[model samples]
Target: MNKFVYWVPAFIWIAVIYYSSSTPYEKQDIKPWLGDWVNLSWAGPYLERISFTYNNQEVSVAAQGIAGFIEFFIRKGAHIGVFFVLAFLIYFALFYTVQQNKNKPLLAASAWAGTVLYAVFDEWHQGLTPNRTPYAGDVLLDAFGGGLAVFVILSVHRKNGRKKKFNIE
Candidate 1:
């Protein structure tokens, strides 16, 4: 198989991330959809008890109401999920395209590095888009997602009895 074939998914995923980042937040708001799909009013009292500040903004049912509160978490979770998948896809591409004997740790590191760099770029791109505020916290969340992917990959390799030293030197 052509090595380039291994990279198609990663490239496509990158495009998806780019397109999502390019959209204005108003178009991406999910509160109305959530309101249409589910009844969260029952939890409003409980949600109202939860209050905190994030990125200089209040995040709670009191600040955003039930639907907005739920949407906040959903959007943050999407950040983690999308980047998690991107990291794994990047690792998959690197595993197939690199020399067979290349160190797995190095490959994992490279995948994580790529994910972080892309997250930085994505945030920067979002900053340029109207109604989008780039938060460093989101980038940290993305890095955590990529790190989780690396951990899962390493754990899987260890479970498969590879026991390869994880040194990146």
Candidate 2:
């Protein structure tokens, strides 16, 4: 029971990603809602204060345009952010589930493998959904997210000498 607890959070997060992905990409409207919210009268002056030059033209004419761009970045960033958390959870679960005397490197590698594999599976799942096509680039991004988390976790563990303290070989 104690060992199972470590996996619960990972499973829940994966389920969340799966549920969200089940929605058609065209139907994903978080961006429009966000654009409307940011277009409030009170936000006009604040939005006006920000400006950027794109193709030698000032591109701050409309708040909605900027909001749409922001939304695009937010969506991609969410992929990395959520996968980072998932990888960390997977690392903890793997670390605890393996027999005693496991090495930190091996545990980290296993976590990365699990995360990348999941990313592949997720993209495949998305492909089966309507109007969604799998992209190798997205898989690479997911792997980067997961790999970064594993690297950070491993560094912290090694810095703290956790291997010796926790009996991780």
Candidate 3:
């Protein structure tokens, strides 16, 4: 694969994150499609069962305003998920670009560092948008997601050993 090809998806995903953050709260909240998906009758009871403690009170999804609560999780999940993909792609791109004898651990660390920096930039970008206040907590969440991606990649790479090739076909 061309080295540049690996970067395309990562850049595009980052663009998506930026676009999502740029939307005003009201415009982004409870997107009709998501609202429909989460409200399916078959999943209603399970969704209601999901809850978390905030301010010393247990808040169920329904109690929190069903659509709003679900939207919060969806947005946070997107943060985690997009960063995960970004880190993974960065690692693979670096792996291919660097010399074969270069230390793999360093490449993994670099990928994570890049992901962290991107998360910070992402938060800053959000701060520039009206009705959006960047939170440090979201950066931490992004780091956790990137870290998980690096851990999974390193673990599998280690398990397979250096000599083995992963044949997708």
Candidate 4:
């Protein structure tokens, strides 16, 4: 019962994000959101700050980087990357939380499965939402997100191990 309770919130939160992301909003609402995210947050300033002049126009390096890297490649397909990231991160979170305890592998796998399923369902939910169109491209992003989480967590583990070896030697 205790372990089940711990698992409940992770699944619920991921489910909520999955469903909500699929819900369509007015373009007016979306525009502000995009603006707020890319133009108002720390990313906004960071992007704006790292600009360079080209043809008398100061272009944000961060914006260019994001566009050229994350968006450009991702636009080619949905479900190729980001959604996986969502899944992977969730798995990493689950594993990290349970690292010092028992049943780490089972808990991690369950979280990973939940994340991937959530992405799939999220795409389905998008199909039903108004003003939103389901794109396999987004699903790709989700997958990428998951893969990235795996990369990050694994990297951290490796780094810590290396650091411990260095200290001992």
What does each candidate score in C-alpha RMSD? 4.2, 5.7, 4.0, 8.8
Instruction: Return the candidate ranking by lDDT, descending.
Output: 1, 3, 2, 4
Q: TM-score for every candidate vs. truth?
A: 0.93, 0.76, 0.76, 0.54
* lDDT (10s digit) by residue, model 3, range 1-169: 6678867777787788789889877787765666676555555577887888643545566775566666677787877888898899888888877766668788889999999999999889989999988888789889988998999998987877744655442
At residue 69, give the lDDT of candidate 4. Answer: 28
Model 2 residue runs over 4 Å out of place are: 39-64, 162-169
- State the lDDT of candidate 1 residue by residue for 71-152, as single tens digits: 9999999999999999999999999899867788999999999999999999999999999989999999999999999999
**Candidate 1 backbone collisions, by pair:** none
Model 2 C-alpha RMSD to native: 5.7
Clashes of each: 0, 0, 0, 30
Query: What is the RMSD of candidate 3?
Result: 4.0
Whole-model Cα lDDT of every candidate shown, in order: 0.93, 0.79, 0.80, 0.56
Query: After superposition, which runs of candidate 4 have C-alpha atoms over 4 Å from their true positions?
Result: 32-85, 92-113
TM-score of 1: 0.93
Q: Pick by TM-score: which candidate is best?
A: 1
Best-first order by TM-score = 1, 3, 2, 4
